[model samples]
Target: MIDITIEKNLKVYQGKQILKINRQFLSGSITKIYGPSGAGKTTFLKIIAGLISPEKGKIVIDDITWLNTDAGINLSPQKRMPGFVFQDYALFPNMTVLQHLEYATGDKDWINRLLLLGKLDTLTDHKPTHLSGGQQQRLAILRALAIKPKLILMDEPFSALDPEMKAELIGGLKVVFKGLGATVLIVSHNPIELEGLVDGELYIAG
Candidate 1:
């Protein structure tokens, strides 16, 4: 289980805003997060991933403390090691699809399986510049899965995919997530996009 209570100051066009959240995420659950445009959904994920530090917060996962502002303890991103799929896809300009997964894990078998799951097996040699927008997004998802992380944070992961592709990928990801027993939190703008995939929902108001 993951427990979090965080407070951060956000900069908005009008003025400063505080983003505060106190929540718990059950183990192995898939959660869909949605809210207004500047509601700090992505910031919430980033804070949990250790990419952004909150002004004050405490985060504990499975009895392990990841962050405790009162104690002046904050784990580094590498130590936290959650699989993060950035909104931009964040693919390497020079690395091919195969290389991306290889960088994350040495197991060729697992890499091949991820490629197949993402439907990028045939495009293994293609670089980010060569892949289409949807393919790039798939590569980002596959790269995150390559590490077999316990916690996966995805920011607008399915925005570029077509409906058919999104549905198929979601089905495959369900099996993979279950097999790994990974807790996933996805930030999405579209409410209905993840209808059947998410086991829980979180709404953050700006």
Candidate 2:
């Protein structure tokens, strides 16, 4: 399980807001996180990834201590290594579709399998600039999966994809996450889009 309890001060539209959360995230489960725009949903994810430091809290992932303010124990992001699919699709401009996954892992068969899952097998040579928005998003997801991370975090990841693309991609990704027993936490404005796909739900309100 991934356990977290933190209090972070965020400067939102209304001014200083304390985003506090104390929760336990089940391992190998697909969870949907949603809330108001300034409710600090993204900030919560960032805290889990060690991108932002909270005022006080402890984070434990499967018996491992990722964070403990009292003990002065805090793991770096690289050590946590939770696969993240950013809202902006943070892809390397100079890398091709294939190169992105290759950069994460050299397992040829795994790379090929991920390409087919994301329907990018035919565009391995294409760069981020060459692919469409949906394709780029898929590449970001594939790159995250290439490492077989134990935990995956996505921030508004499906915003650019059409209904068909979202459905197809989510369907394929469900299998992959289950296969790897990876825990997934996704932040989406449209929670209804997930419907039956998610195993749990977390709502954060302002």
> Of the candidates shown, which would achieve the greatest TM-score relative to the real structure?
1
TM-score of 2: 0.97
Model 2 Cα RMSD, 1 decimal: 1.1
**Whole-model lDDT per candidate:** 0.95, 0.91
The whole-model C-alpha lDDT of candidate 2 against the native structure comes to 0.91
Q: Write the per-residue lDDT of candidate 2 for residues 66-162, one digit (tens) a residue.
A: 9999999999999999989988899999999999999999999999999999899999999999999999998999998998999999998888889
Q: In model 2, which regions exceed 4 Å deviation?
A: none
| Candidate 1 per-residue C-alpha lDDT over 1-206 given as tens digits, one digit per residue, 9 for 90 to 100 | 99999999999998999999999999999999999999999999999999999999999988999999999999999999999999988899989999999989999999989999999999999989999999999999999999999999999999999999999999999999999999999999997989888999899997
- Runs in model 1 deviating more than 4 A are none
Candidate 1 lDDT for residue 177:
97
